[model samples]
Target: MRVYVAKSGDSLLKISETHKIDLNKLLIVNPHISSPMMNITGSKVYFPSSPISDTLQTPISECPLPSPSDLLSSWIPLTSLEQMADTDYDVLIVGSGAGGGSVLRRLAEQWLNSGKKVGMIEAGSLLLPTHVRNIPTVNDTRFSQYFHTVSKWTGKYLPDFPGARQLFALGGRTLFWGMSAPRMDDSEFFDWPMPLKEMKYYYNIAEKIMRVSTAYMEGSSIQEILLKRLHENGFPEARDVPTPADLEVTKYGQIHSDVFWSSISALAYALNRMPFDLAVNARAVEVIVEQNEVVGIRVMSPNKRAYVLKAKTIVLSGSTFETPRLLLHSGIKGRAIGHYLTNHSLLLATAKVSRQQFPEVLGTLSIFIPQTKKHLYQIQMGGPGGEDQWYLWYSQYEEKALLDELLIGISAFGKVESRFENYITLDPNKQDKYGVPKINVNFSYSKQDTEIIHQMAAALNQVSSAMQAPLIVPNNRQAICLMPPGGDYHEVGTCRMGDDPHTSVTNRYGQVHGVAGLYVADNSVFPSMGAANPTLTTVALSIRTADYIVNQLK
Candidate 1:
């Protein structure tokens, strides 16, 4: 395939005609390149068809030509017919969230050193803080969008789906996470078909590369109170034992701190450190599989333009919904492609507390409550920016002077036992622009989950009574915190990892057992939802996968 750049007079239509390719076809490859209404100048465009033989020899000196292998080939879209085909890569890592981002960085470093090409593809458009803050409506919560989507409550009981649940931006959801990095309980791994010892080492390696820190929690009032209460109430504190220099801080501190200070942004800044190519705003529509082995990925961009990224190794890090949707569209159905989906359950119970100011809480410093005894064991912490409004009240919305106190938002997360009832399916008639089926995420709570919520709420109420703070449940008027499937970016367990490929999509190493050079390194591969945030574990698995790949290459 050949590349082209635009001149002052080159409109997409004119380019297609001059290159002898269909104009309509050209529009497909460059859907979003156009602005909200018209085309934006100096924006990179991708044409769908290949260049004609006559047009290939016509070189314009105004536009610089680059080698096909060069990462920045050209800004022009494909314009020639018959040459619009898929490109191949040594490794094609999908998604760009925690799992995909880490693996891409690691592989890019290794591949650059080895003089091999590695390709990283992200479905969402690249996220920029400057662009977000510039937008008028979203400026106030620009930070939230920078990180992850907000949670919503449905009715008074069920979970509500938020308009902004998942952020489809360049860094994936890492931009919004509170950076709570806790390792999965040994029991969580024991339940899986793989050995826990191997996973532990991987987790350690990932934590190190991420530079997880606990310094953010040093003087946090919320962490202190929660830790003291847990200890005083006979609950166990997060393990804070010392480790070697190689393993610096406590796992809890390493995982849960602010992800704004994460390695992801650094990798983005060091894009030149990569050997192959990183394509943002490119959405993978389907995986090219032949004879049960993965071959390549077909993607569609905002311009409705289609292309392929063929690879010897294919990694699906498109999170839960996207990964499964891609596989299903690719006709690689499995027993667990979209089953066992789980996310942390949250409830926003506000109250009028005696204290006007809420405690200065560190993100993710939760009180761990064990469920063995069944007195409502949970990990509770402040909600997104809830600490800021702790002492403020709504003078306009509520009874003015009756209760002008601060509101605290606490999230109670517990174990979500797997259930087949909660799963993902393709919407029958709803097709995306690519003509692929849109995902229908069926997020329902099992009796066990509902019971757990009840138990957690009861325990929280007990704490409130002790503090003499009257609980103020949000009116069933609208959803607040408790939201349905895909609410939080913590979705996992679709392409599960286990010992048996017959039952699991990928093996413990994240390799698709039946297919060589195919791996699933994102949250979708988790076999079980541990009672902790999944980012740390996902990062660990990505690091582990990178090491395995590096060793294999050696």
Candidate 2:
């Protein structure tokens, strides 16, 4: 359990050579250190299995060494419910996904030196320490396989919501989310309950914390040439996709090992600000309500034992599906608690382009044709990838023996209307091991939704043709493929936010109607899934909600 505090001018090479530890073993144990040449100053390098003998020579350093505790410790500590039950929390977050994580980040940032108590409970145990794509070993193929293995396919029980899946880990689905962190168009929020001014203010904060940048593809030749083609040929709205990545370098003994952003990243920021009680494998089965206010949450342990954790406020970020289920199970009075389920109508088209179309240094492509007044869908085109449209940077692929074509994929997300008919309700006949009833979904695309899908298909064609990439269809498949509902993994609006008690579960501030201290902050709170990825907007709303909660406390 011995740890080394990395000092200036010290790296894995120097430490390995000086300490007589195998260099390969050092990398194996310290996954946090991405490269041997990285400046690991202010980092705690562990020697979990290495043995240090008394006969070994004393280590010499170019710079003064830091105390063990002075260096950065890269571990999230968990507190058991047995102890957590004794102390009350100011805010108890139900799930640790993007929504819950953002709420925790804002609160911890604001209350860094304060004594405000915060607690978070996650149903699943710690999975990946960061985003799956951030890991060096994970590529496109392994990414899909690994994600499928970890996440719970909740849609299996619901025939209508067959594509629905839930990853109940500490970081939730963010571990596998594609990092398209675009802000919803200002026009999209024209009719929202909250003011556009507040939404813009929170979006800036969310993007700042997430390190959202458009420079990821700035220097890439492939992106440059293809995007130019799109702009020249009718699709002038195309631009570089906004990616959530920490492009910062380490400096002055500070470490920046985590490059890709995830909820785990948010949790890390929160911990750096202040310690919060985090209990994993703690499934929230019911919310305890007193009169019309939320009192606490009844959480079930792995062994089926239930514990009630007291909190002045509770934010449900369990997700679009799980949040509604919990509300219905608790019998919380909300006419729209589980109604108005909505997801984007997804359309996909893939084509092959000549590899020689661009310069030899073929970097990856990520172009975004955003949702506009004329078009209700946004198109994200990326590739020169392999067989499908996997990002070439993250996946390994074999060259096409007969052809010199590069694969390009365009995904169009068409905005679907949030209808009251498409909703989720608990199945009284089914109860899980924790004694909570399962949820059933009644979802179908309306005529307007189907028309949007057609429009998305035409748009995808125009863009692909603009890039001079001929669309290719798989055997017996249409050129424009319409993915099933919920296939996008961007389902939303079950616990939508609005001012009406009968039409919305939570108000614009995210508080549940008629219920004080109960809030919804996940994808569930989005009134509509406006053809943009919900992660970025969800984080923005969660931050705004956190600010509201802070004001209430004050």
TM-score of each: 0.69, 0.85
Error of 2 at 281 (Å): 0.3
Q: Candidate 1, after superposition: displacement of residue 237 in Å?
A: 2.9
TM for candidate 2 is 0.85
Give lDDT per model, in order: 0.60, 0.87
- Tens-place lDDT digits, model 1, residues 441-463: 66677788788767767666655
Per-residue lDDT of model 2, residues 273-383, tens digit only: 988999999999999999999999999999999999999999999999899999999989888988999998888788778877878777778888999987888999876
Give me the runs in candidate 2 sitting further than 4 Å from their true place: 1-74, 395-403
How much is the lDDT of residue 407 in candidate 1?
45
CA RMSD of all predictions:
17.8, 13.7
What lDDT is reached at residue 275 by model 1? 48
